[model samples]
Target: MLPLFPITLAAAALFAPAVAGAAEPQARALQPLMAAEVAAGAPGVTAYVDDGHRVWQGAAGVADVRTGRRLRPTDRFRAGSNTKSMVSTVVLQLVGEHRLALTDTVARRLGPVLPYANRVTVRNLLNHTSGIPDNATPPAVELFKGDPFRRWRPEELVALVADLPQEFPAGSAWNYSNTNYTLLGMMVERSTGHTLAQEVERRILRPLGLRDSSMPLHEPTPSGSFARGYSLDYDDEYNQIPETLRDVTAHDSSGYFAAGNLVTTEADLARFFRALLSGRLLSPALLAEMKTTVPTSYGPGIRYGLGLFFFDDTPCGTLIGHGGGMPGYENQFASTPDGRHQVGIMRNYEEAPDAVTEAQGTLWSKAMELACAA
Candidate 1:
């Protein structure tokens, strides 16, 4: 077993000021579970879960390993691929308002940019059925390794994968590709005559009063106090070069573009998903379309529906949310299908032990445990 960080002043800070639900006796266990995450090798972890009536926030581990600053429950972090849900929500909103159509082919909007744009439709892009090859090129990875702060344009990222062969015939099957969301971002820009960030702010953030959430674009650092992100140094082949961890808290997220560049706190994420599922965000018909899912490549019982993921077979009934991972950060979020219960989890360190799946499984089980409890 890995050495666990004791509940020092940094960890003890949470047990005092943390929110706990009076009706949720089981919710009190969240802190111990988060401590287990640190014992399992996560540098720091924060979790927030709301059961509609009560909200509980838990933190365990240091914000910085060197300085031993206690992790703030409100601290923001790179939301990574969680940005996909917001982008897709905006596009679907546009679809509902007659600004765009799901059947609209990418060629109709961006013919010159993507080689196979004609064969792919907006619906295909939203559902990851576009079969667009991923742009996570070796060169890009090398660049990330060499200079984590290197800025990138969405077009520049798209150009790198344009000439690559399609993963499969467009719309023939389901495949998770970051390239699909990249195109959606471009489409949003072309359709609205505004940047993706602007549209998201106008349509989602501002209306929901999610003051803590913002798309960082090329900005390498977040606005307020944030937990530092760390990852094990690895070579091109993902072979761990050393046991040492590198601080990647300020890594430029432009490389992720619209697909994974959103920064938000757990509260903001919960609020966004709550509003979305409670019928506040989209029309009934449109939200229904968003929930209609197909089996994903992730694993059995895990389905992908538009930008959201449906946990079909969890112990907590079924959940609807998404998971996001970047270089030095990762997050997991899930809520009941009706949005009455929700949980958002964050870990500062991206690298994991060989039992990464097991570590994640523990979190999933914990979320479900809290969700199903009294």
Candidate 2:
């Protein structure tokens, strides 16, 4: 049961206030919940919920710690690994057009430049069944940690892990590897003879009218009024070395590249996932293929599909969307199986206090409540 507050829906809409001028009661529960997250140690949080008819959004805490600027729901933030879904959508569209096949080996598609490319399949890359180890090794992190504005070439990024031992034999196990999608991005570029950003804009963003989203090729910061991302700069031993957070909003997302370089707002993310799940983005057959699940090594009740995740054991029954993390942001967007109800949440700080994670978990529970109600 939702926490009964004896307030009417309209009054509830005023609980945290809405950003888009009008507020929905369905979104009321999130405002204070987000506030609690901020109080618990998150620098800021912005969230939106679409309950079929209208979209309601809320923000909590500061966008910048230096000036103490309030975070707004309208502000854009890095979507992080959520970019994978957009990339996968473009790849699937090509597959639908008969330009590529999921079974096509990476070596066959890209001419076997990398040693492990021939052994990995396109489908393996999409579902993370490929044993490509993540490229964010300690050396890479040490090299880039203080130099956030450095531009990284895609080949250089892929070369970091191409020669490393596989995490497991291809298709034998599951481990989340950003390198898999980075390779997929290369494949998309090779297959289409266009940049991955160009293909995504032409195929997904423009078609969906996601005006607030973009693939940041070299920009280190989001355009417009964007939240300033922060990191606690914890060490490998989980010890807080600096005892203070650093502003990381200007870090070059080009390092993440096709794996997680997307800059988007909560509303735009909600819209994209809604369209993807509604059969408006991919064919019914491909959409089904996209939803086919393999156990994500992350946790139980969570399964990785081609590019999306299915959470069936949640209070909202089955919902599909992906959660993303970068150096300074942790975000999630989930929608009902049929795309009727959707929610997105963003926290502007990573490596935050444990209480922040607990507060965010509470927000997830609230999201389930809102989705189930919808």
Top lDDT hit = 2
lDDT per model, in order?
Answer: 0.78, 0.79
lDDT of 2 by residue, 1-374 (tens): 10111111111122243355534565556767876787666778887777666677788777766666778888888888899999999999999988899999988987655677778899999999999888765323642344656678778877888678888889999999888888889888988999999999999999999999999777867788888877666465656544456566776677788888899898889889989999999999999999999998878998999999888877677889998887678999999888988878898877566777799989978866776675
Prediction RMSDs, each to the true structure:
3.9, 6.8
Q: For model 1, what is the error of residue 176's alpha carbon versus the real structure, in angstroms, after optimal superposition?
A: 0.7
The digit string of per-residue lDDT tens for model 1 on 1-374 reads 11223223222333332334534554456656676666666667777777666778766676777676767778888888899999999999999989889999988987767777888998899999898888765433643456767777888888988888878887688888888888999999989999999999999999999999999777767878788777666666767644445666766677788888898999899999989999999999999999988878888888888899998766567899998877668889888988888888888877555443366567667766776564
RMSD after Cα superposition, model 2: 6.8
* Backbone clashes in model 1: 0
TM-score for all models, in order of appearance: 0.91, 0.90
Off by over 4 Å in 2: 1-24, 138-144, 234-239
